[model samples]
Target: MQQDAVIIGGGFAGLSAAYILARARRHVTIIDSGTPRNRFAAHSHGVLALDGKSGLEILADARAQLAAYPTVTFLNGEAHAAQGTIDDFHVDVAGHEPITTRRLLLSGGIEDRLPDIPGLTERWGKTVLHCPYCHGYEIGGGPIGVLSTQPMSAHQAAVVADWGDVTLFTNGMPEPDEETLALLERRKVSLQPGTVDVIEAGTCDRLRVRLKNGRTFDVKALFVAADLHRRGTIAESLGCTLTETPAGMIIATDTVKATSVAGVYAAGDNARAFGNITLVSADGVMAGLGMHQSLMFSGHS
Candidate 1:
């Protein structure tokens, strides 16, 4: 049986799109492996009304609400492969029958590649965070550490300074040039040229940052600019266009969330570089609209 649409990844973006399609009386199937990008975080922030709720909790509630629509079907598994053209896509699942759909949405999201530092990975989403707007208010205005992962870390430190006192640790990067140093001085962002040896849980909700030189600093929280990568190969397998961003490459899409390939769309972190809960939800909405519009008009002429 051919579905109106097959959405890969059942996170906020995919679920939001599914809701839209379901409301329109279209048959939609969502394939999700059950792991979300923000699963490591205890509570999600930046979204109105539902602030501080765990991502999983919000998703659970969403799933329950989506159950009201008979047009939506849920498949709790991964999409192993996707092939075929617009209006004739065959998606092979891990342990289920393949699905045929008129339109495809890629919302597999992205994965964060944390720096190779001890104690940091264990504290991710807690003591070690990525977004200031999401976790800064809870962290309060205290001492904060920024571990440099790429050239963008300098700008990241400057932005994080708006939340707390910031120290940019240039783990292995070369020291900033003269002009860059001047900007850091103006922003009051301190530079730690020492290579970080380890990160440890400190007293009073802080992290102990130990330098390879044996010097240490205790900070209320540590901010890191982690490298982001797309989670799966479904988009590439279908020959969708990928756009390069400072963090990584994401699926390229037009304003309506339609990708370069006809009958295909992308949403969530996989489609855009910058995202929080609200933005990805918006992506889902646009993708839903784009897919539905295409489905309605494609048969004309």
Candidate 2:
């Protein structure tokens, strides 16, 4: 009826926290809504030791390994609301009984908001992608395109240029600064100053970009630095302050992953500016260890 921690997600962050807490002989329950941000990504890369595997495969392996721990439970449900202080938290999941825990870890991750280009959404995570570290190697040395949605899109294009021939499409956004323009010219990255109407991809993996000015460019991959937002509404309800990053405003937490709200912690994409899988997992470990130490110091264990 009682648990040491309730993790409100099932992604790399929540799984890592639950695994660590369970190993410490703590009762931990992870409530997930069965949707991860990387679901659309066919293969997950850049994570050490498990590179180039499907996101589902990595999660399945993690779940299988965590099943051996007796203190961990996975609930296929969403945490609708949370109540009580840190030492005593009550979580309500839709269509399920409420769960009580001594601490709460929120790793609900974020949602990526892509541009309104006609075919870009459909090709997301496959032909139209983000994060060079995650998908760059797979599409390396190929003709790549970067769709400009924000000011940072130029920077993303510059970094991704190292892996392929780069093209920057200003999708109704302003032009870059003099320095940026010079860099693009020096790097031989073409700049298309027009709105993108759609992205066309064939079954054979050929990708094409159609511009509003009746221009089309051939490319194998497209990089979009989409906007990000928290997937859950619980953080704001709990009065957790958010700090703005290049992607979005993530829940502000200290080095140990403790949020402003005492007794509640955050990890993964929800708490970190750079929300890579490896970084998120490390944040979860730190939060879990910190929670355990707090419990031990309070003589709660």
Candidate 3:
């Protein structure tokens, strides 16, 4: 049977959409490779009641709850390709038969491309992070390092000062203009113009930021605005409009999460340049409602 909707991800956004669809008795299939963007983090914050739960744990709970719905189905695999439009979408999985659905939802999330620095990868999502709102509170105020990845680093450095004594590591980037320097000075952000050499764990839950010039600064945590890229090509394959945001490219969608291509929706990080659990979860809810309304009015299924 052709599914009413096929959500091509199983993270927070995908699962949340699935929950809503299943509640409405829509036959939905979720195809996911199981590699969520926030899998590296041990805990999730800024969520309503589920704060402090690990992201994986949240997914686990969501999956378990979704299992209670007979209309929801899970497929643990990569969606290799996608085609067709509107009420007749086709998705190809890596190891399974192709799926036909009346609607498609792309929530595959994004991939963070960290800089080529030794020890940075291992520390990411732990001591190294991106958004201050998501992980800043637990950092216990002061001694936070911002590793410059893009021009936005200066702004990030200034903002993070609210959570800690901020250090903006220019890391070979151009020096901030006088106005920006003055802003940083007002924010009490320290500027380090040296290029980064390496990052390593320091004593007592701190990170050691070592510069190429042999200068080292120890901090409770490090922040970086890593370059983000969409994880899957299904949205592109289906010719959905993509928007370029300050964070990166994302699937462009309407307020209700409907992509440019009718009957195809997107939510979560794939649809948003910057996102957190709450925002992406709401994206899923909107997409679910929008798809359901489309189905009901258009009589697709």
Candidate 4:
């Protein structure tokens, strides 16, 4: 019977929960795999007081603050397998001992499948961005390109046009409905219909997208809704119910981040339908309190 609250992911949401739990004098152990979904992003924006800080810097600062709480422990490894139930979960860490805890926080995160375009991976988080609100201001009203991956790209083009010159590139994505196309036209978003052949790095950290039809557009940034895939088999291994959305299947959690399975909680990207750093960090706070209360009341069971 272990007493520590185990947080399996150590990203923003993961760390946020750990700090709150530790402050309450609850023993916490955060096991981080060190593989971040946002490792590609140079700076994490829209976070108060932490804007423009690299993802690495933000995590380092978070871990530093948690150090003040002696009960919080940090381990580096992946969750190869997990067993047991809430308030009594066992997590096996590769190259380390198994962690058995009183409560589990599954925030391992989601993976982004960017379009298979050359030069896009390198420029990601720098020039090739995803959320307009995240990286739009940095582009500063310049030429922007939106690679249509889902039907939402039409809406993305219409919304992003406010930031700068926006071009809707439908690289063989599903054709938008007539109403959506009409809305995009009204927004003054230029439409290009062709498969992107190659994306090359350009001067001044710009991007050059060449099409199969021998067309090109050099833009300051590229926006995409990369198909998201959940990381690891933690949710599945825990017998947690998942919900399906346009994006992908995600661990379904209630208002306080309680999943369908009891004694198991989730926060951050893997738990939410949509999320940003600020939003997920808030989720972590709620989850931290929720787990603490559950532990305090479990003796009544």
Question: C-alpha displacement of 101 in model 4, angstroms?
Answer: 0.9
Writing each residue's lDDT as its tens digit, candidate 4 over 123-163 gives 77778888888889888998899999888788989999989
Writing each residue's lDDT as its tens digit, candidate 2 over 1-301 gives 8888999988988888888888899999999887888899988888898888888789889999998999889899888899888778899999999999898999985778887778889888988888888888878587889999889888888888888999999888899999988888877788889888888864457788888888888898999988888866788888888899888889999987899998789998888766677888899899899888877787657
Better of 1 and 2 by lDDT: 1
* Residue 51 accuracy (lDDT) in model 4: 88
Model 1 per-residue lDDT tens digits across residues 112-178? 8899899999899998999999999998888999998888888888899988899999999988778
Every model's Cα RMSD, please? 1.3, 1.5, 1.2, 1.6
**What is the lDDT for 74 in model 4?**
90
Q: Model 1 off-target regions past 4 Å?
A: none
Candidate 3 clash figure, as a count:
2
TM-score, prediction 1: 0.97
Which residues of candidate 2, in runs, are more than 4 Å off? 202-204
